[model samples]
Target chain A: MTRLTFPPALHAEWIKIRTLRPQIGALAAVPLATVAFSALAGLGAGDDDILFSAFFGVNFGQIAAIAFGTTAVSAEFHTGALRLSLAAVPRRGSWFAAKLTAIGLPVLAVGLVTGLTALAAGAMTVGPQARDATPAEWVRGTAGCAVYLTLMALLAAGLTTVLRSGVGALSILVPFLLLVSFVLGDVNGNAADFLPDRAGQVVLHSSWDGTLGPWTGLAVSALWTAAAVAAGLWRVRVRDA
Target chain B: MTSIDVHDLTKEYGPRRAVDRITFRVPPGRVTGFLGPNGAGKSTTLRLLLGLDRPTSGTATLAGRPYVSLARPLRHVGALLDAQAAHSSRTGRDHLLVLAASNRIPVRRVDEVLEETGLTPAARRRVRTYSLGMRQRLGIAAALLGDPGVVLLDEPANGLDPEGIVWIRGLLRRLAAEGRTVLVSSHLMNETASFADHLVVLGRGRVLADTALRDFIDARVHPGVRIRTTDPAALENALTRQGHDAVRHPDGHWTVRHARVDDIGPLVSAAGVPLLELSAEEGTLEQAYLALTAVDAEFAARQHEEVRP
Candidate 1:
C-alpha cells in the first residue's frame, strides 16, 4: 500500500467553506447587520454605552454564523457528498477537526470585526453616555464576542454532524438559542446565566452586573461548545458516511 | 500483486442485508468489471473496500492492507464513486486542488489530470454549472490526480455521451496497460464487454461468478455454429442423428450449439448435405451476463416460493 500523506485537512476545509457563496454571505451578513443595527439603535437611545448597544445585533448575528457552520457539514450530507469527503480523507477525526478549524476561524474574525465596529460607531453616536467606558472594556467586549461566536459555531457544527441534516439541526438550535433561553431565563432567574448564549453574552457588556462574570460566562459557553463537539465527533467516527 | 481481497464481507441495514458473505478478489493489471443488476451490492462492496462503510462481519483489503491503514491512500488507490458527489459551489479546478492538497499531490498534477480528462476548459467553472458528463469527467480527473496503482469507479459511464464513453474506455484500458488494478462497476455488460479482462458478477449481495471474461462467456453462454445450406432439412437431420442439439431458425438456417465450426463442415460433408454457407456465431458478454442473471432470477423466485409456503 502506498503511504498517503495529505496536507493538513484544515487547508482543504478552508477552501471548501471559502468557495461556497452561502458561507461567505453568512459571514459578511454578521458584521454588516451588527453595525447597521447598532448604529440605528444608538441614534434613538440616550447618551449611553453606545458600544454595547451597537453590538446588540450580535444577539441575532451569531445565529447566522451558527447556520453557516451547521450547513458546512450538513449540506455535504444533504447533497450526498459526505461519502466522497470520507473517501478523500478516511480519518474521521482529522476531517472533523479540520472542519471545526475552517468554520471557527472565519466566524471569529467576523465576530471581532462586527463587535468592534458596532462599539466604535455607537460610542461616536451616543456622545457622553459612551464616555467613562475604558479601552479595556471595549477590547474585552470585542475579543469576547469573537470567542463566543467561535464556540457557538463549533456547537452548531457538532449538532449538525449528529443530526446530518441542515433543517433538522437548525430547527433545534434556533429554538434553543432564541426561545428556550428566554423562557428558561425567566423561570430560573440568575441560574439561566449559565446557558450558552446568555453566558457568552457577558463579554459584550461594558458595564458589570450580569448573572455571571464575563470570564465565567465565557467558560460556561466553552464547556457547552466542547461537549457538543465531542458528541458530534463521536457520532461521525462511528456512523457510516 | 496489488489485488483487492474481500473476506466474508457482510453489511446489514437493520434486518435487511445489503451485502452477505460477499467475497471476491480483483487482481491487478486488468480491468475487473463489477457487474450486477441494480441493488446487487456493487456500490456497497466498493465502499467496504475503501472503508467508507463499516462491515458487520468481514474485511476487504486493498493491495494487502486495509484502506484505512494506509496513511496516504490516494497514492495507492483512486476511486470515483459518484460523479455528482462534489461541492457544487467550488470551481472544478479548486475542487481538484483541495483533493490534491489532501493527497499531497503537486498542484500541477491537478492541471495535468484536467487536461487528461478533457476538463481543462471548464476548470474555472463552478461544478454546479457543469453538465452530468462534465461532472463525470471531473470525477475521473480527481480520481487520476495521484496516478495511483489502483482505480475504482462505480458506473462511471452512467451519464456520458458516446464520445465520453469512448474516452473513458480508452483511459481504463491505458491505465490497466500500465499495470494498475482497475475495478469498475457497471450494470451495462455490453459497455464493459471489451474493456474488462476479468469479471466479478454479483447477485443479491453474493458472488455469483468471479472468473475471466472468456471463461465466463464460454460457460454461461453456449457457443454455437451457424450453417446456411441449400438443404437445411438434411443439415438438421444429420445434426440430430449425431446427438447434437440443432435448431432451425425462421430464416431457413440451422443453428447448432455445443459444436465447433470445423466439426460442422466435416459432419455435413460426411452426411452428403449441400452446404452453401457455414458461419460461426460467437457468444457475446451480454448473452453470458443475461444467462447468468436469469439463472439467479429463477433461483430467487423458487426460494421466495419455498419460504412463502
Candidate 2:
C-alpha cells in the first residue's frame, strides 16, 4: 500500500475551505470588521494608552476569525461530510492534524492583514495620538495581533470539533467573548487575566498591570488552544463518525 | 484481487445487539450482494467492516488487513455509505477533486470519474441543485475515483430512475468483471438478483444464507407449473395418476409441483386432454427474500412474546 503524505491531505483540506462561499465570507469579514470598528474606537481615544486603541478592532475582528475556524471544521459534521472525509483518510489523527493546519495557515494570513489594516485605520483616525506607538511597539503589536487572532481561530476550531456544530460553538464563544469578557467587570488578579479573550488581548496593550507579559499571555492562550485541540482530538478518535 | 473476510462479528448498542455473530466471505471477481431487511444490521456491518464503527467481538478485514491499518486506503478500497454525504454548496467536480487531491490522485482523475458517472455535463453545478439520482451518481463517481480494487456501496440504487438503475447494474458487473471485489448492499432483491453472482443474506443480524445467487433462488423458491385445460378434472387425474401432486384452484386451474411442463404436457396429451394454457412459474428473488424474512420475523415475535409473558 502506498503511504499517504501530509501535504496532499492538507491540500485537500484547503480545497474544502476555499470552495465554500460562507467560509470565504467569514475570512474576508475579519479584516474589514476589525479595521472599521477600530477606526471608530480610535476617534474617541482619550490619549491614555493610545496603542491599545489602534487595534481595538481586534475585539470585533476576532469574531470573524473564530467563525472562519469554527465553520471550516464544523462544516464536516453536517450532511455526513466527516464520514466521507474519514473514508478517504482513515488515519483519524493525521486527518485532524491536516485539518488544523488548513485552518491555521489561512487565518494566520488573514489575521496579519487585518492587524496591519487596523493599525493604519487607527493611525488615520487618531493622527498624532497613534504616533505614540513606537516602531518597535508597532511591530510587536501587529505580529502579536496576527498570532492572537490565529490562536483564537484555532481555539474555536477545536471547540467546534467537540460540539460538532458551528452554531453551537459560536453560541458559547461569541457570548463569552462579548458579554463575559467585556461586559463583566474585570474581577482583578490572575483569574481574569487567564480568560481566553482577555489573556490574549494583553499583547494588544502596550503595557499591563498583570503578571503575564504579552508573550506569556499569548502563551497562556496557546495553552488553552492546545487543551481544546487535545480534547477535540480525543473526541474524534473515540466517537462514531 | 481483494476479498472481504468477516468472522464472528458482533456489535451491541446498550442492551440491544444490532449485529450478532455473523461470518461470511466475499470472494473477488464477483458482485456480492449484501441482502437484508431494514434494521437487520447491514449498515452496522458495513460500518464495522470499514472501521467506522468498532465491533464488539470478532473481525472484518479486507485483504488480511483492517481498514484503518491500510495506508492509502482510498487506493485499496472505495466505499460509499451515503449518496448525499457531501457539502450541498460545492460543485460535483469540486467534490470529486477534493477526494482526488486527498489521495494525491491526479486532477485528471476527477474529470474521468465525472465522465464515467455521466456527471460531466452537470459537474460544475452545486450539488444542492442535483436530483437524488444525480447525487447517487456523484457518490459513485467519488467511490470509483481511486480506481480501487475493492468497492463497497450501500444502496447505490436508492433514488435512481430506470435508466440510472440499468447504468449502475452495468457498472457493478463491469467492475466485478475487472477482477475487483465488489460488495453492493440493498433491500431491493430483484435489482440485486439481476447482477449479483453471490449473495450474503442477513436476518436479525445473523447470516441466514450465504451461497451463490442461483442456488439461493433455486433452493428457496419452489418451481411450479400453472396449468389450465378444457377438462380440468381429467388433467388433474392424469397428473395425480402419474404421481404428480396437482392441486385444483377455485378458478378451475391446476398447479402441478415437482413436475416439469414437458412431462406434464406429454402426460396430458396421452390422456386426451386439450391444454388451453400452460405456464412455468419459478421462484422470484423477492419471493425467496420474503420467505426467509417471514420466518425470521415470526421467530423474533415469538421470542418477544415469550420474554414479555
Could you say which candidate leads in TM-score? 2
Model 1 regions lying over 4 Å from their true place? A1-7, A47-51, A179-188, A208-210, B237-243, B266-276
Residue B250's C-alpha lDDT in candidate 2?
97
lDDT of 2 by residue, B1-309 (tens): 489999999999889998999999998999999999888899999889888888999999999899988767788888889988979999999998899988888888899999999999999999999999999999999889999999999999989999999999999999999999999999888899998999999888899999999888888788888899888778877888889988889998889886677777778889999888888888888998888888888999999999994
Write the residue-wise lDDT of candidate 2 on A1-241 in tens digits: 4565677788999999999999999999999989888878877778477778888889999999999999899889977689899888878898999999999998899988988887887788888767677878888889999999999999999999998888999999999999887765555475878988888888888878887788999999999999889999998899877
After superposing all C-alphas onto the true structure, candidate 1 shows an RMSD in angstroms of 2.4
lDDT on C-alpha atoms for all candidate structures: 0.85, 0.89
TM-score of chain A of 2: 0.96
Q: Residue-wise lDDT of candidate 1 within A1-241, one digit each (tens)?
A: 3443334567778888877888899888888776777777777786345456766777778888888888887867845488777777888887888888888888888888877787778778777677667778878888987888888888889888888777888998898888977676434347677889888887787665766788988999999889989998998899987
RMSD per candidate (Å) reads 2.4, 1.5
Model 1 chain B weakest lDDT span, ten residues long = B68-77
What would you estimate as the lDDT of candidate 1?
0.85
Provide per-model DockQ scores: 0.54, 0.72
How accurate locally is residue B178 in candidate 2, as Cα lDDT from 0 to 100?
Answer: 97
- Which residue runs of candidate 2 sit more than 4 Å off their true CA positions? A185-190
The DockQ of predicted model 1 stands at: 0.54
In model 2 chain A, the worst 10-residue window by lDDT is: A181-190
